[model samples]
Target: MTAATGKKVLERRLPDERATARLGEDIAMALRTGDAIALVGDLGAGKTTLARGVIRAMADDVSLEVPSPTFTLVQSYETRVPLHHFDLYRLGSPSELDELGLDEMLASGAALIEWPERAGDRLPEDVVAVELTHDGEGRLARIAGSGQAYERIARSLAMRDFLTGAGRGEATRRYFTGDASARSYETVTMAGEETRVLMNSPRLVLGPPVRDGKPYAEIAHTAQSVTAFVAIGRALAGAGVSVPEIFADDLDRGFLLISHLGSEGFLDAEGRPVAERCAAAAQLLAAIHARQWPSRLEAAPGFFHDVPPFDRDAMLIEAELLVDWYVPYATARPAGEALRAGFRAAWNAAIDRLDRAEKSLVLRDFHSPNIIWRADRKGHDRLGVVDFQDALIGPSAYDVASLAMDARVSVPPEIEKTAVDAYVAARREHGGFDESSFAEAYAIMAAQRNSKILGIFVRLNERDGKPAYLKHLPRIRNYLERALAHPALAELRDFYRRNGLIGGTA
Candidate 1:
């Protein structure tokens, strides 16, 4: 099948209502705010059933009641991306849709319109259309779209292929919330089998070189491909660290079917850090740091990826995000070149201290969100680590700082101190552990990480249209203040105060 827009139309054979529901859920994964889906089918053709599937999937609640909108005209759902399920069959006329305010709804969220033909010429031109027909005991679905909607359709088809290749071709797919990055996830479930997570992390495209002929990703040592995740995952598993087991993978396409680590995280339901889980996570970090890390690790046979050192350049570039985005965002003016130069010099001087500190595999984001708490496992094995693709060879204290001063959840001062003490106590067993030097490094890294996060959250809101992250800015700012209290970061603290970036000091 194909569309007039020059894009291939995807066709699927849904054997039953279950299969139809799975199809809807898969489609939901590709949906973004403002996209419209037109469901075209005859009466009792499972149109409403499929629409319910999409609503439930987006809500991440399988049991969410999604009543047919046939009577209500339209049923709107408050999902991660707001959704409006419209049944236009009872509309008095095509012009009546204007009174329903659909354009306004689509501007803010997605719309799933059933019986779109009832609207006549009022239907959106760029909408994705799913045509359903009875195929013997099963149903046949043909999906077509144009523009961004077409791209989404293509990605959905790709996801289907990936799941089929992973031996879960007929499994139901449920949309999983995505993170700050371009990566996405889905929970795939097969009858009589344990659930698995589908990680859809496509290879990052390098933008026009912005720094020394390198893109921002390269300058910041961000993972450009899934090879890093595979390699680092294997390395962690080899060391007996609790990580999700990879069941299948398409490395080039950046798809992986891994074991689900349950939804229980290190933070409680109220968003406060759990003390026991936090201590375990710190101990896990100590165990990881105790191991001798290699410069290059094998991602696959004959494929080795060199672990890039978190050198002065990477540190300085990350800190520069403050001046690059946050400064202008907070001050309404860009930093002058002299200000930028001074900022760079100050960071360089502080980051230089990392050279003399102990180095290890630094899992850059070892916070509550990424750490899964496995009560069934023992000791460090109870912590299931995820999102380590950006791991680098850097100061051991970097990961500690990441854990102790997590960005996503509030870690009270006492809890943070306990975590720090737990990590230091664990490290002391290895002998020759200098707590003082480690504390200095932790403070420096904490300040750097928080500074980077402030800018990142602002960029997410201003540039990416995601304002939810801004809620954590004050928390991050507080962490930065605490870190600056250390005398070793006195100069950096003074610099921040001088620039009026933050107030007060140790």
Candidate 2:
């Protein structure tokens, strides 16, 4: 379908579940309250799945059940912005839709319609039509939107891949402005005097380094964004992680002079060996889990209660990417409904088990890249952590999965076992241990983590336009497969393999 102004219709092929979900996310972000999306596709053609991704991303706190909406006709969820998900298959006429206040919803936030053809010309002229068609093993979506907003978002998605090769295509500057620097227009500073005073603060965050004859910091920083970075870095340091010791942070102008952690993380200190790394990383996780978190740090777009039970939704969403992207592209066919149903059942059961298990502090992103190696005040090698603002209360095992089978780096087999054993031993030493139950919890959490990573890698590539993440897909699949090797996950392992995910195994 042509856009109203006859601008070229943007055509994108969603090669996997991840790409489809990303398309949905991009479309969701591009939508204003008054916008509308008409989706047309066949069964298992990724209509409801894409819709689910869009709704969830847009309204992070609301529970978005992307069931056909075929029976209910429309499902409404509370969003930071309002959204109406309409499935028109059950509706016989436009009148049936009008009765549901379709027009009014279209005027606010967004109205995403599946089986939109059933609604005919009743949709407004400004509606964006996203058509999904199955290709060889993947799917192609043709998108036609009302205006430049859609093009802008689509363009942004086209460019952002977590592991894109597009690094500093242009030169950049780094700065090392120290403490007591003035708020120059080119600098970033936090000017609120009411801010806490520090006695003899030692670290400094530097910037505007020269890269290929250009000032990298100057090229990258804007007044508003630099301010945000300093604010967050300070917050994390205050929250107790050994963030690069900031000698100074000026948010108002745009300069932060901070200390740098040494290049080697605990993960890379080969001389210390695997067993040592795991133990140190585990201890760091424990400390982070013990801290009191500020309420505002909870993830966005979804409500506290609505967040996937113990990050269950996150796992399921990632798995869906396998269905949406990897399976189709790798195998050249959509995953069967029975296969999806079985996996979903496994996921739901996992979530239920997690919810029923003991809850502890969760460092949601406990992995290699986020860690810095340091000798604690006690003078032993310790783990310094970053990227943990999304931490929450969860099963201790989740963090275990994150470190033991990290996606970014490989943990040796013996080392992984040692880490798990040490963590369990620590629990016992602490005197509140249930050995058998803890083992079960760890296995279950491990399975969930692997599945979630699989989904995320795909999402990063296909949806976020960051195909660089695909390199990690094999590792993630290997992790999942290994987790499945445990006798407890036999059924889940078979199910995932039969459905075309074997860590590039196929």
Candidate 3:
């Protein structure tokens, strides 16, 4: 089913609910080994209809009565890989999914689940998420997933769509088809050499905000910019930072596709302790910041407004949002006006202090999530650095703050300090800055940066409604407590203790 290189399209309208079911069946029939299809949409939104179509198309012997399973929980069918069709609508909690042994089934056969979002984190990381929307009598289906299995299914769907000319010559192009129904949108590929492609979505929420219905810049947010980032990645290669190479970037659609840097981020890996990891992280930061930039961002205005230190307002805005949106939500009455006031003072003081320090290039979001622990011949044991689309010319200590006081992962105090020292030593060895004051500035900035993170995490849960970030609040607060414990922050620490921050928001 693999094509060396060719474009294919397919299209068919689901005139009715039954037609949607038929479409699903066709998609299922095209599935190869290791396929998982997750159906998502509102109630009676044709998810079941599509699932039925897929089931019918895949196995001729299977029955057509694919009910919603609102009560039975999950109805298993015998097909290739023994397809398990789940209706989580009635399943009260995600843990109940484990009770049904869905994990084992996911490995052996295909799984079709309706209301998959209810399963949340339990769903397979690579499971296909198919969103079905009822448009008048027809249905619009959007499919997204990753892995070799989904890749095959995507290829098959695209082939079917191409054979049938489903959405050809339209304003948008069909990227793939399942059974008779095709899902298409504006897609741009970055590089043919690498499988990972940079893509852009002018309409995707993550896309930069639109003004007047047109994108911001003429070259604005295209595959080309992704390529530039990749070029930067290559430049940083062998220089201690282990960033993924950019294979392609499709700017028209705003996709900065690049190599997948493996799944063993600090969160997934059971490698070193927090301190050891932070130490390694600090070493990388040292190498990155110590290097000279060819041009200052202010000197080259239009090229990159995203790079750090140059765009102070945007960076400050991110921190301010954390304070404005996160603090009130994370803290209880214990964090009264005094405690809150102290926190603000610390942030402002640190920001002011660091704002005046000698500046260097900073990878703004240099935390655990951005790192990948991959194997290589380099003396270091793991790959590090990613999610650096917002790299900037700012305080060298900014990225260190991001690493030692990570929001997603905790670094031991001893380890954090050791990492700080290591960065200081490395910076001095590279020979450009004053060591004495840099140490003081590093501690102050670390505390301030982490305070901002605490606010950001709280805000992520309270404002964005993504509560998962709340789990890391304790670690962030830990960093804050330690940073405040410094003699320089004695007054801030006293204010916090009086207010209730010592033990965190209770």
Candidate 4:
């Protein structure tokens, strides 16, 4: 008989049970919603041990109880990625596979089948085959598949090679967290509790043209590569900001092994803002804005990243997200040309007023989520900043507004005032501060950021299949109302109120 026609994806020699478990951990990173991975071998092969590694990694618990389902025929786990371990050795009859509910399991999550031969032709067409065979002093494991599952495995394996070059080949990899964008993170842990972050921020693949034949990412000045993060991290560090140090990097491939900052944030147990930490974050922003920043930054000796200007066009494009996504979602109808015209006109006029405002390097997202609190550190160092890749030259007050009106949490009126008052007091101490101009800029910037967020949250839910952000809509609505109260936004406030976006009838 001819050998299997499937393309072999990976071949690795597992020298011991630890190496075998590590391979399973790598495989776990590639698992998707409907994947079927067949663990093939004889009875004494390390099939059950490999499956346990996958289960334990996904569950993020080293001692998770993952007993073989040989007697029970199947055992399900409620990990981050729901998984089912199927041992079909004693499957009795092929017809009994129906009761095993492979299809039903695949409909929700993925499955790991121990005896693929017993399932016969009932196995999925896209099944990934992992065969274990006895080697001279160890076991040889082979993985093969096609379609999305194969592509994912290929990507994960490539990352493993990258890790090997970075001297973390034997480290355990598990999901750390993910954000709204394509970027995801994994915590790579070496022996003896040394941990680092593996930032998998692939070069962006922009979407279809949204305006002027340019994708929204381009118009919005989104970071196209890991260079943005690298450049900005260095820039902040030089300015005395506490940003993570990049330990290793494959910039072209968009992979970075960075220091893991502590996990403490400004939010309390109930997800509410902590005033003291927020005030500290405010002081951090003031110190940042006190200095002048260059528009271009050197990421490496020769490689450079130009920090994009938050010009009128980019500001207009961001504000229109409210018109494009939030307006329709709110009114149950697409915004007409007249409404869009009114909205853009109001925003353009407000942006025109920004030139008179003080200028500095603005971290476009200076809210609570991106700020890591380090209580052990001293003044300004207490805030460990991350996610400043989209930093731009803009009004100095924008970051102050961001902390006062955090996008993720509800900063009550008193706490919001505390943040702003702290920032104002710090800027005054730094000298050459214009309180009146800063107030005007703060109101306009707050309103502008809220408008963009209102639309982005809706877009994330409808277009990106992320509904978790939708819950923040009401909180944003209130923040928008507060920002509109400033007399500087009288005209813009009128437009929003007319559309029932805020208070007052048209």
Candidate 5:
């Protein structure tokens, strides 16, 4: 980072084409919507080669054909994050850029503009400038940028440094997927080594205080750093659960080189949940909940990580998301204090019944997206779980609800029953498992979790500039209805119904 201009500048000698390709991977990981990359270099300076690398990485295809837009002037590709490759070498004039729809393209995605100097003042003020030049039979590259792109690129370069320190410096990097959280993923491949995953989850920042002078993450017991993943992951592995093996880690920087837990997920080809896989995942959860878990884990030698308790305050604050965000969005009016008070009172009463409930390490978001299915492996090993950084010591039934009422995909009633049965059967076989107590706890947890999701989706749409999550609101509502049917959630159901959030308006 430059002290005067705050521009992030990195100078490196690209010894070969592979070095330039690796640099492209680093830039691809740093990309965000509305970002622009100004490839500054003379002809034959490896401009198109670098752009091809970026496109291929984003496409998650190593051999993807990326032609230079020299003649056509601009070409685009459909990717997780859409990208446009522009070559202005044959441009008629600078105004042709507007005709080419650069502004409109950047609204939804990013652009890679080659020969960016031709555009003069038309280029975005916020841009990442990559200067490539001939350097003694090789190439010299200088990357300079600022803003969110700068921070992200700095982190991305640091991740490569982490990999280099771990002895995987020459590994190929490709964008995998990103979650609703701050984490993003990349697949790292090195010849003769098993494919590994690079999780770039930076230390979470506690945002402005929302209640009781605390942020929502605090009240929700969300993980603050990478230490939680290391702690919970090691603990789960020790208990015979099939979590990803941590090969290398930088807990302070929040970068982990973990074993690539296969690509197959709980969903079948048609994008629906497979019953057998759902049952298998439930059994895996049973194996997890059967054993006792420690409240504090030694994440590193002499560094203890105390698993936060998902207590009453946490539960209430989570449910309040519905009243605070979803209720107003659903009804098109802010919830009155009277309605809010009633909802809070009802939830407080509902949580009181959990005094006799079971407790375990709850993998809060144990749904389809997080479950990796390995058909070749047997028993519990057949399933691999990730995204457990926010694991909490909470009601064991919480995870059961998460699976059966999966928010990412629709789980039919039969599949839901299959999962619940698998869990109950495995727990029962282990002895001292109380079925009746679990039923109520499951229903209450399902309701609470769904309520929290409803608000979160709305917050994502309204506050976070991510409107895609709005599509899942209806599915979440239907799942919330299923949870509301339980006797344990009677009063909470009444509050919803009175607000026309569920069945029977009157």
Candidate 6:
């Protein structure tokens, strides 16, 4: 297969219905809102079967019924992302598609349109054309597109090549959830082999400088590439911390095939944090903080990443997110210059105390969502950690606060105390652990983190169109109040109260 008009094209041979389904699943992983997958093929060419596979992959339910829309014209399903399955076989002309509400469907979600050729030039400009033909025993698919759709098709092909090069060419791909960041994940399974995970973290395209001539990601020390994850994962694993083992990597493309840590999370079925699991996670953090970690890490031969320290500038900028996005959200107006100045001053004063605290490799998101429990492993090794690509050299208290006052799940006051005590006791065994000062640092770090999150969640809702994070605001507010209760943060608490950001007197 070849591109006819300089557009990107990918061709694959599907030896059977299973292979066709697998290809559909891979393509589904690359689908996003506004993407239109135009399925064009001859009758009895397994187009509906391929469409079924794509729908099931996006829905993550293999049993989902996906009947052809020959009579219904269009069938819509609510999945992780909404999907419209369109069969234009019965359509008489292109203009008739306007009656199907195609524009509204594309605006809200994605579409898989079979017999799209019937729509003629009415199709969206970004449609990815998947043309299938009957092979000797199965089928051949040629995918081509332009613009963002073309880029997504190219990425899917790259992932296919990566897996093939890693000796899992025939593996089936399944979509895993993506986070608020630029990365996404998938699980790949091959016959009679242990399942593996594919971390599809493309190199970040830096935005225009937001502060100090640096992008917001660079200023905040966010991971710029998969190298950070690879480097940090190896470093942690070398120290006997449980992390997914890297099996294969395409460093240039930012793809990695890694060991699949099972789905047993630190929380239970009811979404409550288990006390024992929380304690173990705290102990794991203690073990990490007790070690001496190097500032520079080797990601690959002759390539190194220097871990940036969590400095005053980074902390202040993070806290400013509250001023940047949250203040307007809460107050219905942008923060005045005075309010911004006061906010910065309070955070600077609070961050000054971090200099006296114990510093170590801080797994920045050491919360429930990133933690997996291994029942077969011993001690801290039972805790499987992921999403540490953004780790930094910071006060140990930050991670403890992240775990104890977890943002995703509610850690009850008693459970939070138990976890905190476990960490403190474990640290004491290593000696020279200052309980009084550590408590103060924990409070400050907790307040700073929750403050940043308050703005981040709102930004995600308003700017990024992701409303799920907003649901955690009440929990984050409670955590902030708990952190503010510490006498060390009284002045900062007063500032929030004065600004009417929080209720009650300081």
| CA-only RMSD, every prediction | 2.6, 21.3, 12.2, 2.8, 1.9, 2.4
Per-model lDDT: 0.87, 0.60, 0.59, 0.88, 0.90, 0.89
Instruction: TM-score each candidate.
Output: 0.92, 0.49, 0.57, 0.92, 0.95, 0.94
Task: Write candidate 3's Cα lDDT for 1-506 as tens digits.
Answer: 22542322223456777656646744664464456678888877887667777776555534667777779877887775488888888788899999988878776677888888788799767777777777777777666665755655565454334423422211111122111012122222223332232222232323354444543222122222443454445556746566765443333333343455555656534634465556667777777777776432321223433342433343444445444655456454223465445556655554565555767766666777667766453544375565554455666776777777766666677767787887887777888767756765666666666666767677667655557778877777788777776676676567556655556543
Kindly report which residue pairs in candidate 1 clash with one another. Answer: none
lDDT of 1 by residue, 393-487 (tens): 99999999899899988788999999999999999997878888898899989999999998899999999999899898888889999999999
Query: Judged by lDDT against the true structure, how good is candidate 2?
Result: 0.60
- How well is each residue in 1-506 modelled by candidate 6, as lDDT tens digits? 24467667778989999888888888888888889999998889888889998999888888988888899999999976789999999999999989999999988889999989899899898799999999899899998877886687678778988999999987878877588887888898988989889999999988899887889888888888899998998899999888999999988899999998888888888999998999999999998999999999999897788888888888888989989998898888899999999998898889887778989999899998899989898898789998899999999999999999999988888998999999999999988889998999999999999999999999999999888888898888889899998999999999998998777321
Candidate with best lDDT: 5
lDDT of 4 by residue, 1-506 (tens): 11577565678889988988888888888787899999999876789889988899888888988888989999999977799999999998877889888899998788999988999799889899999988877899988877889777777777778899988898889988777777877889898866888888888988899889999889889889999999989999998898988988988988888888887776887888998998988988999999989999999988899999888888899989999999899889999999989888889899988889998999998988788888898998888887888888888888888889999988999999999999999999999999999999999999999989999999999997678999999989899999999998899998898788887321
Q: Give me the runs in candidate 4 sitting further than 4 Å from their true place.
A: 1-8, 90-104, 117-127, 146-148, 504-506
Better of 2 and 4 by TM-score: 4
lDDT of 1 at 203: 88
lDDT, model 4, position 169: 92
Candidate 5 clashes between residue pairs 3 or more apart in a chain or in different chains = none
Q: What is the lDDT of residue 229 in candidate 2?
A: 34
In candidate 6, which residue ranges exceed 4 Å CA deviation?
A: 1-7, 13-18, 44-46, 59-65, 133-140, 504-506
Candidate with the greatest TM-score versus the true structure: 5
Write model 5 residue lDDT over 398-451, tens digit each, in one string. 999999999989898999999999999999989899999999999999999999
Between candidates 2 and 5, name the one with more favorable TM-score.
5
- Badly placed stretches (over 4 Å) of model 2 are 1-172, 175-240, 244-259, 269-273, 290-311, 375-381, 463-467, 503-505
